[model samples]
Target: MTVPLSRPAIPVLEAGMPAPDFTLQATPDQNITLSELRGAPVVIAFYPADWSPVCGDELGLFNAALAELRRLGAQLIAISVDSAWSHTAYATQRKLHFPLLSDFEPKGEVARSYGVYRAKEGVCERALFVLDGNGIVRWAYVSPITVNPGVDGILGALEQMNNSTQQDTP
Candidate 1:
């Protein structure tokens, strides 16, 4: 006999809106909020968990593309329901330099705010939100439970947004 398995649905965050602000604890008790990075674009990636296989590969892609992301004048942040200790351990193991914020206590508060929390799974789905310098969400993507987001797609969207802003100025 065999049984079928199911995964929770992926949630979506709409574009062209203000991203919900959150002050999650990162490594060493440091706090991160959307408002602090007001002058540069920010990419917030919400993944299921720290030690999971897909989560590991997704974060690794970001780590490997750090230089490119920086050159685009953007900062990358990964959020999960894991505790700071877990995030620290994962970052160390993966050699990931970017901040991985912890949403552990309330257990998916930030994820729910961002509309990415999978209540049944007790974690967030693979979601990406790109907020402009002023904290306005410029683009968003939500991947299926079994699919991974395209890193290049995110970078490309950022590039397009950057270009459009420049054109609008003069």
Candidate 2:
């Protein structure tokens, strides 16, 4: 008889921690490295799948809010366990302006690092993280699997970051 090894649960990342760096395929031929996006605020949205209803709505909401996100000086990138080909198709069909990075090869590697991977579901929890220009997490939120975490929280976090930056300036 053999006993099965259990994988430990990963703690969800929180504010004030350094955001994990990763390089994920954005398209079949292009990859985006998190570290390279430094010097500008980054918004990472991790959803369960690319084309599911909730995921679609959540990403579509983000897509429509791109201008506002840009005004806050933040770049948004969505992540999922879907393959690069799937992401490319989905992004094109949805007409999303932001990059949809694939966490597929290792299957949720980036999500696990961010503490958002859902093992049983084989997907990522609906989670969001706002990283400051230096790559420190400014805000983090994990919504229920069935929920669509709207953009208000992300915008608020960026606004708060902006305010703090101004306050810190002499």
Candidate 3:
């Protein structure tokens, strides 16, 4: 008798909707959760896998602008289907300062919850979500599997969000 494979359900996050909060183990066994960064804006980038060409470039952009993102009062977390061990190796290999999370258990729980996981391949598509201080999704971008999300576009969106917030304050 052969057992059938089951596909994971994907959760779609709409614009202006509250992002689901989760706590995952980061490198060095540190816990990183969305709620912990609620006072500041956040950019949650979901990628297919580490060490891939486009993913490498996308992450490199974040790595290179770590200080700039902090200056913008934004924190970043990159999630993937790879194991924490894989993330550790990748982080060390790239010398990344930000946490690269593992959504390996339950096999892409976070990715599926974020609606980026590709069930057949057991991998996530390239997706980006910008959440404001209140945890509302301000902007979202999901790239085709073969395409790379432009870094400038994401930066521009963050700038717009910052400007909007500034205008709202009395």
lDDT of 3 by residue, 1-170 (tens): 97653333655586889998988768647768889889888999988898898888889888998887888888989999887888999989988889998887888887877777888888887889989998998888888776778666667778999898899999
What is the RMSD, in Å, between candidate 3 and the native fold over all Cα? 4.0
Taking all chains together, each candidate's TM-score versus the true structure is 0.92, 0.94, 0.90
Q: Which stretches of candidate 3 lie over 4 Å from their true place?
A: 1-11
Winner by TM-score between candidate 3 and candidate 2 = 2
CA lDDT of every candidate: 0.86, 0.92, 0.84
Q: Where is model 3 poorest over a 10-residue stretch in terms of lDDT?
A: 3-12
Candidate 1 stretches greater than 4 Å from native: 1-11
TM-score winner between candidates 1 and 3: 1
lDDT of 3: 0.84
Per-residue alpha-carbon lDDT of candidate 2 for residues 1-170, written as tens digits (9 for 90 to 100): 97642221788889989998999999999999999999999999999998899999999999999999999999999999999999999999999999999999798889999989888778988999999999999999999888998999999999999999999999
Question: lDDT rank, highest first?
Answer: 2, 1, 3
lDDT of 1 by residue, 1-170 (tens): 85543344434668888988889988766888778888999999999888888888899999999999998999999999999999998999999999999999899888888888888779887889889988888888888866778698789878998899889996
Clashes of 3: 0
- Ordered from best to worst TM-score, the candidate numbers read 2, 1, 3
TM-score for candidate 2: 0.94
